[model samples]
Target: MADGKNWRRAGYVGAGAAGLLAGNLALVTGSIVRAAGRTPAAVDDGPDPLLIDPPQLMRSTVAPTGDGTLLHVETSLDLDEHPSDTVLVLVHGWTCSTRFWNPQVNQLAQHWPVIAYDHRGHGLSEMGEKKVSVAMLGQDLEAVLTSTLPAGKRAVLVGHSMGGMAIMSWAAQFGANMADRVAAVVLTSTTARDVVQQQLLTPPTLPRYTEMVKPLVARAFVAAPVPLPSNELTSRLTHYMALGRHARAAHVEFTDELISRGSPRSRAAWGAAMYRLDVAAGLHALSVPTSVVVGSDDLLTPPLHADYMAQVLDHNGVLRDYVTYGGAGHMVPIERSEPYNVLLDDVLKAA
Candidate 1:
């Protein structure tokens, strides 16, 4: 009887020790995040005139998710202008809306028909059921494509960050139809795997510490009690994580507005999905002609991701071109719009 009682006491002690260790790790991570928050952001001298305005000639439509959710889709047609055979579909990243592609719409809409849409729980879209996953995002893309594009029309698909991931998920589920519907694909600043493991935000020397802190960071991204506001700290963090160091103040502000407007629940839900993201094998199914673009200074989805994607696409005999912007960050679409636009135009024309 005494031995059994001692064993039970030992079990209690072991559980208590584990709880205490976890509590200490959480406290440490909290302190690090707070320290990062206190750092000041560098301000740019002036705003770029080109980025000051939003897109015009946009028509909004709603596409049902078939699961009681409605997505907000914006289509720009050059009916009396330089209309072309190919349609350009733009997908924005996490914490962003269709407005995130305003610059691209402004440049591309005058030539080809352009379609941009907000993900579930973003922008003018209504949030459906609470469950969110990458598969759901893929389904959303499929619905938007089916509802927006005409029959027998093919599209040149462009996606940034999580938007790029959505394209992969879509290809995975609907690869057979992709050859007929998708003319080409452009993946910008995205990865297929090792997102958490290969992140550059945390230092390499502290692997164990980073592993402990990753879950906390993911939680904060989705649903922090006191959410990070549109302040200097938030701006600084956005600039660091998403934009280039040479990014203009106007660009940073533009990016921050879209990010801050995101729904916390949606953000958290999608963030949890990102934690388990692994669509590397799905790349094999993406048999369409493809292009990859990345920023040299991109801390989120660094150049290594671009390299791996290029290699995989090439091995599959589907690579078209791989381009890297020097000193650019994850927000390559906005940071280097002139060249990025030109590159996109070239891809569209080639397709």
Candidate 2:
């Protein structure tokens, strides 16, 4: 009885200590990133489209996930001027909302009908009772597709980070019916599996421990559940970790704004999902013409991940292209928007 009590006490103490350490680690890493990473480009005085005048989209409608939870889905279509036959369904990564695709949406909406949705816990979406997992992301995506996609019209799915995972998950789960709706796929700065093992967000030594790092420190980093600080230091850190060398000051601030809005509960929930992510089957299941884009210096999901995914996508003659932007980081979609737009143009043309 005494031993059980002592063990329980120790567990409590250990958890508290871990939480404190994770908090401190975040600050330390942020400082390091600010110090060592490239300086942001000059800020233009003009109002940034993302922050000041974000393009107004269609009504915010609710879409039910596979489990019956509602997800916030919005669309932008300029059918009167530039009518396009195909659709673009954009999904964002962990800790981000539909606004993450604002850049692409603004540019592409002029020609293509664009649909973007928030994950269950991000933005205005309702979190279902089920525990969060990569599989659940795929399920949510399916719900969005079923709800918004017009019957008999196919759409191209574009996902970034966890968004990419959702696409892969969908392909794996519903590959047999994929052709019915999915016209093509675009995976940007994402991985198939073993993200913790392959990621460089934390130091190298942390993951070497067979027992601790993968299961503890790295996961703890994502699952910290602490509110994101919106200070200049935190913005710089976010820029360093998520953006590439070419990122501008506005980019950093924009990214920080979106990240800061992420609720603690949602961050913790999705962090765990991403930490233990494995979607190799989904990668293999993708039957549509697909392109994998990676920033050469991405720390979250590095080029190595893109390499493996490109290889998997190539297996069934489905790989249309593989691109590595030289000075970009994890957010290749924003960091290289023009090039990304061109890539989309190619995909839509081919589709």
Candidate 3:
């Protein structure tokens, strides 16, 4: 009991410290103290160096949306032996881009062809017209899958955070048709529903405070310079905050990469969708093997959320698997890549 309490307490402390550090850095970097603790070494020292090795094939284009809104899409494909038998399509979470899956892309490419794309408004993808909805994202995925993957062979849908919600919405709307196309499903650091009210590790909604501060967050995100303080600070805070209680320097560094690629608008859009989403009713229709993975230390999408997801699917007579990582948080893919890849590979083989 004491051990569990300590782990949870440490998780919060890690998040708080990281958040405080990033917030301070963003505010202070424009001042003289910029020389205080600023350096690449001060940022990351993990197994692999930071951004030295980018994905093999970095490609992007504006894909046409039926409604005339362009879908900004960035795709990375491995150079060698791209698997045709199985394809994996990765969807990123709110405020994040495909770059977060860098580690997984590097590893998974060895065995299977992997594709990671930015959602419409996030990353290199074109922003949607008025507002981004879960349904819109679902439609985007459907269009991508139709064009990219073969007519007969459907791809595995892997989503993190908001990405997961998009998959859920897709599954709910298309039902058996989507199920036939999906060989497997992976939900990481994501919720079945109620994401806005429950997942964020924030104070109670002060609508007034949100209205007052949103412009600042937006301006801060847009006006920030390259290798900017916001990116650095968030990368650090999210890494520190979400690391497994026993996480090492390498793990933190990997997780940092994911956080750094996150987008402000994507985060906000998905947060709104999470609050309004209700895919719980659709879980029953999914026929593919589903995997739910989360960190034990995750506050935003806790182990309980994964447990609830697994239970709901099981109750509906669906076969699903649930995994919990120690000392990790809302960034399960980066934090637990090896285990995640193994499970994904196993599911692909079975599929």
Best-matching candidate per lDDT: 2
Relative to the true structure, candidate 2 reaches a TM of 0.85
Best by TM-score: 1
TM-score: the better of candidates 1 and 3 = 1
In terms of lDDT, which candidate is stronger, 1 or 2?
2
Residue-level lDDT of model 2, residues 127-236, one tens digit each, is 77899998888888888888888766788999999899999888878778677889899999999998766776654433232333234556776888899978877776
- Among all windows of 10 consecutive residues in model 2, the one with the lowest summed lDDT is 205-214
Which digits, one per residue and each the tens of the lDDT, describe model 3 over residues 14-52?
Answer: 999777656644443332123212312232335753223
TM-scores for every predicted model = 0.87, 0.85, 0.72
* Model 1 misplaced stretches (Cα beyond 4 Å): 1-43, 53-55, 78-82, 205-211, 215-226
- Minimum summed lDDT over a 10-residue window in model 1 is located at 218-227
Model 3 poorest 10 in a row by lDDT = 31-40
Instruction: Evaluate all candidate structures by whole-model CA lDDT and list the values in order.
Output: 0.80, 0.80, 0.65
Task: Show where candidate 3 strays beyond 4 Å.
Answer: 1-45, 49-55, 58-62, 74-83, 200-228, 231-236, 249-263
Give the per-residue lDDT of model 1 (tens digit) for 1-351: 999999999999999978866775666555545544653454577775546445466777899886969999988754224347688999999888887887787787777888899988778888787588878878899999988876667789899988998888888887786778999999999988766556666434444634665655545544452444687767777877677767678888888877888887677777777777887766777888999999998888999999999999999999999999997889899888889999889988888
